[model samples]
Target chain A: MEDTAVLSEIESGQERIDLIRKDFPILDQSVRGHTLAYLDNAATTQKPRVVIEAIKRYYEKDNSNVHRGIHELSNRATAAYENARVRAASFINAGSSKEIIFTRGTTEGINLVASSWGRKNLKSGDVILLSEMEHHSNMVPWQLLAEATGADICYIPVTGREGLLDLSGLDDLLSERVRILSLIHISNSLGTINPVTEICRKAKEKGIVTLVDAAQTVGHQPLDVQEIQCDFLAFSGHKMCGPTGIGVLYGREQLLEAMPPYQGGGEMISNVEYHQSRWNEIPHKFEAGTPNMAGAVGLYTAMDYLDKLGRDWIDEADRELADYAVNRLKELPELEILGPPTGRAGIVSFLIKNVHAHDIVTLTDRCGIALRGGHHCNQPLMRKLGVESTARASFSFYNTTQEIDRLVEALKEIQKFFNQ
Target chain B: MFDDIDDLYQQVILDHNKSPRNFRVIEDADYVAKGHNPLCGDEVEVYLKMDGDRIEDLSFQGSGCAISKASASLMTTLVKGKSVEEAKQLFAEFREMATTGNIPDGGLGKLEALAGVYQFPARVKCAVLAWHAMAERLNGSEESISTES
Candidate 1:
């Protein structure tokens, strides 16, 4: 009972909630003259005032090209940029700041690994194992790599009956020839939090490197690279309340040291001559040219906002909201929730039986309720679930139980309209 | 806000969607085409039964949003027994009505209710998916069949 009380306190940290919400001024606004629900958090979250101000501050005061100039602004810019790297390292519990390389977003991060590590390690007969629930960002890159490197791509099927990654199939698929096991930490479409630790452990036993695409999981849950023991993890800052065009690629220091640099540019090189040049070490080697300085500052501020909120508090809130939404939505006869009803991370994908997803979205929008409708960038998973499209409502900590009630009410109206 | 969606999803449109006129496979179809909106995965297959200048029968099949379904239903009702030249003229009028947000002076016939759809920019494709497919079929461009949004 004491443990339960402590859990409740951790879940409902009032001070933290007020502090975090205060920083995000956009939360107070209304849409179409109604209070904005902002349920499309998985696509890209709204930035807080702190993150917005950080971008403004960088442009106003610390604006300069990093790593090249000898002037004061340049030095400040470089320090601010590297400071973000340190923050990113601590955010994911990476060994060193050198392991955190900034890229455009998760898409670029996966591509970097596919081109650099994949090009070197994968051979003609080798296999690359990926989950059936992978986003197109994860799937397409491997497919392109496999085509170029003569490697075979294998999938761990979901089957939809269990709505979990097929661990039994993982045992059968993992072998000496399987070079890398790339999977999403949490499904963007289905919201299934995969058992990455177990998958990583099994892959390690088979002497394979693992890459966890935590695009949807990182900010929603506490993640430690050391605890998971995955070789690499990637996530986009934009999805976690930061600005676009800045994301983190967390790689093991040793592994990052070995892989070839992705792009050739000014800051990434050690020394340049007329003929050839040597590349810089780890993070810098991969981060080519002028980085997204404003974007990095925004991410830093966003991380600071999350940290102040206390990660556990946000996680619990999101989980409770998701549970409430699932339970309420299930009450509608026409609404069919996809994937495992429970164990889902703050997302619900469902189809209104007779109503087309696009129509549902359109009608919902008319009611000032925004949601994502389509394949959610996982066409293969859509096929697996025997659905062409679905309406997805992904929540964040800012989402409230009242919002879930609104969603449920909206869904019932949709069903009734279609039935009539 | 939604006391009843039947106002937007009119009874006539629902009736047309349920039992769409000209919904069948044309056996001796001169031109056949399919249109798709990749963004929404809405598809429509149009089969035209042409007897020289006059359209003997026109039919369509596929799946899509209510707008597309209703538009296809309306299209069949408009062109079922019309001449090829008359059908082309209707297509032009329909296109103008959808794109320009201005209904022609003489009422839109059965298609008047759909004028509200132009207010929704994203749904214009849903209204035009079948019409575009019909145009592709009329042009005898079977290979050029495509979905538009």
Candidate 2:
């Protein structure tokens, strides 16, 4: 079916949410003898039929090592794998397919930039600045790299309770000595959306490199790298309704060409001498061995699925869900919602009075609601908020107000249970 | 299905968490040790005031899940008057019970409230964090320990 037709069908019906919900088979089940209300999209999204079928079809039909296969299967595998690069490139509006490289996930993508670009550019007196709200995946690599290079790691303070960056010291922070400004496009723990385009523009004026961790934003929003114009953006496919163990690092062609190859192995080399080996081109140089080809195919289908639903449409739905969730949660006076009160993305982190996050998650799981409770790989942000942890419920377009209602009800019972 | 959860969050656990016993600093503590559960971001400090081989007073200070807080509370209540060697024996038995489901012959008395903890593997560490800190001070090892270890 055409994108517009399927989208119109979804929009046309009075109660066609079941149509979209039915696309996800796993969500139809029960957990712990209760109906499933999965709210852990930030951790990993539930895969759609299209993504699952795409992955299965690839494995059943085109199972071969890419780039070096001798038969038809190998050629088909290589073509499908490389074609995914183009789709992904178009997905993010990257400059070219040459600028996109495949990696294990957001973790490896950041490590690549830290190990490759960081090693080449950072010096003793230079600084690597990160936002206070960044996930550990984005912060840890820079910390290790800064230590290795004797460069300093400083934070752009969170301005207020909203968790926005403290832009008052922008000029002081992004100085001549600052080499990189790596920040989150959207915080997973607190759902504050950072103005990366504006931040990137400032960093550009200072001639500083900027890397955006878009792990939380890509699936729910319509992204355009040309608009942000950051030097690099890293995101994971698993968080975006695709398969796990696959991610993308989008670097400018010139920057990728300048950095050293992150890992040296087979698909990343041009020639192997007895003592000297020449590296491959921009992406291949960065992607070392045979890549996760089926993962690429699945991610391509996942993006196609999102595009068909329409990124703008999904974003609007997610925003509505978040708005509804906040409004519903306000009924519980004991609960305090974190992040902005309104005009945020798909996540809501909250805490109930005198209730530990782990206990909330445990009780909610009994009702078949999956919530993330802990520092959420954002210990620094948790400390900044003066909280040990908060329970987060993240949504994709497939989620509905009904699930949020269940969550609120479950939380009320949980609070009552603890008070007992 | 959540009968286990109800068991896990018993009235005793709730009461102990609401108003923990011996939850303070032993000002003249002879041994002090800290324990952290990195996964849950919980911190605990176990202080012991000993008179030769007997424990004169004991207390704990920190914040965590209800299970950890309650475990610390009950632990302090049970170990305050016991001798140092007796506390060590109880720690060994409780550790065995919590981890391996090998209940000691003595049934652990009030500490049996934690038997529900074995059903939830992820929470087993929370029930043992205070014990780890107390053991650290008693055995004279590292100043700070993480349950992750």
TM-score, each model?
0.93, 0.97
Best by TM-score: 2
The two-chain DockQ for each candidate, comma-separated, is 0.58, 0.62
TM-score of the B chain in each candidate versus the native B chain: 0.88, 0.93
Write model 2 residue lDDT over A1-420, tens digit each, in one string.
222125564555325566788788899999988889999998889988888988999999998999877999999999999999999999999979998999888989999999999999999999998989989999999989988999999889996567777889988999889999999998898788889999999999889999999999989999999899999999999988899999999999999999999998899999999999999877899988889999999999988888888899888988899999999999997899989877889899998898899888989999999998888998888887898888899998889888999999989888888776
Candidate 1: chain B TM-score equals 0.88
Per-residue lDDT tens digits for candidate 2, residues B103-142, read: 8876898888887788889889999999988987788796
Q: For candidate 1, what is the DockQ? A: 0.58
Runs in model 1 deviating more than 4 A are A1-20, B3-8, B26-31, B83-86, B143-149
Weakest 10 consecutive residues of candidate 2 chain A by summed lDDT: A1-10
Candidate 1, residue A325: lDDT: 89
- State model 1's lDDT: 0.83
- Pairs with steric clashes in candidate 2: none
